[model samples]
Target: MRSHGGRVRAIITGEAHIHADKVAAITGCLVPFPNYPAHIPMQRVDYICVVDEIGDPAKIATGAAKPTTDQRKLLMAEYCTQVVANTPYFKDGLSYQTGVGGLTKPMGNLF
Candidate 1:
């Protein structure tokens, strides 16, 4: 993990609310109280994608490392669609994060 100023770099792609405070507590850095309530339960996944097979041109333009695949894109779209449909909290004004995967790219279109 990289640290700069008051920020601590932990997870590469996912919800910061999931890891930020825990990271701060583990590293003994001062935890910044979030303006929002910590009601979202912490979930642990077996794995999280840190890089994709198809590199995002947008990230590449900015020198970020990652790539995405067509298959991944298709799967992401299907899964993300299901997630949006199944979850009720995905309404207007709700904050959410999508990973930088090819499948996740079309999430906006789903909405």
Candidate 2:
């Protein structure tokens, strides 16, 4: 954002994110609040807005992370469980991530 000359950010303090923290820290990108003092040396932010609400993150994530209910997919999860459990690679301390997929989360549940 700094290399782009300036960037605009709409902030809702209730859902502050780590990426925003890094940007604010590195470039002091925040605009001063209505009654607060300026807190930047070189402002990379063209505009900063404080909004009341974005959405309920928990509700959004719950909807997005929902697993598959299809019978075929559920059977696939069962097959995956059987196959993986029989494999040498499925030993203790096996590490995996359940990222961005409906099937993946259900597969994890089976094991």
**What are the TM-scores, per candidate, against the unseen true structure?**
0.34, 0.42
* Model 2 misplaced regions, further than 4 Å: 1-64
Q: What is the lDDT of residue 71 in candidate 1?
A: 73
Clashing pairs for predicted structure model 1, backbone only: 52-67, 53-67, 53-68, 54-67, 54-68, 55-67, 55-68, 73-103
Task: Report residue 9 deviation for candidate 2 (angstroms).
Answer: 28
Model 2 residue-pair collision total: 0
- Residue runs of model 1 more than 4 Å from their true location after superposition: 2-72
User: What is the Cα root-mean-square deviation between model 2 and the actual structure?
Assistant: 14.7
Q: After superposition, how far is residue 101 of candidate 2 from its true place, in Å?
A: 1.2
What is candidate 2's TM-score against the reference? 0.42
Model 2, span 1-111: residue lDDT tens: 222222222223433333443233322243455524434433544444445565555665566566778889889878978898899898876775666466777888887
What would you estimate as the lDDT of candidate 2? Answer: 0.60
Model 2 / residue 26 / CA error / Å: 20
Write one digit per residue (lDDT tens) for candidate 1, span 1-101. Answer: 34542233433343233344332112222235452444343242232333334454666633222334467666777787888777888676776666654
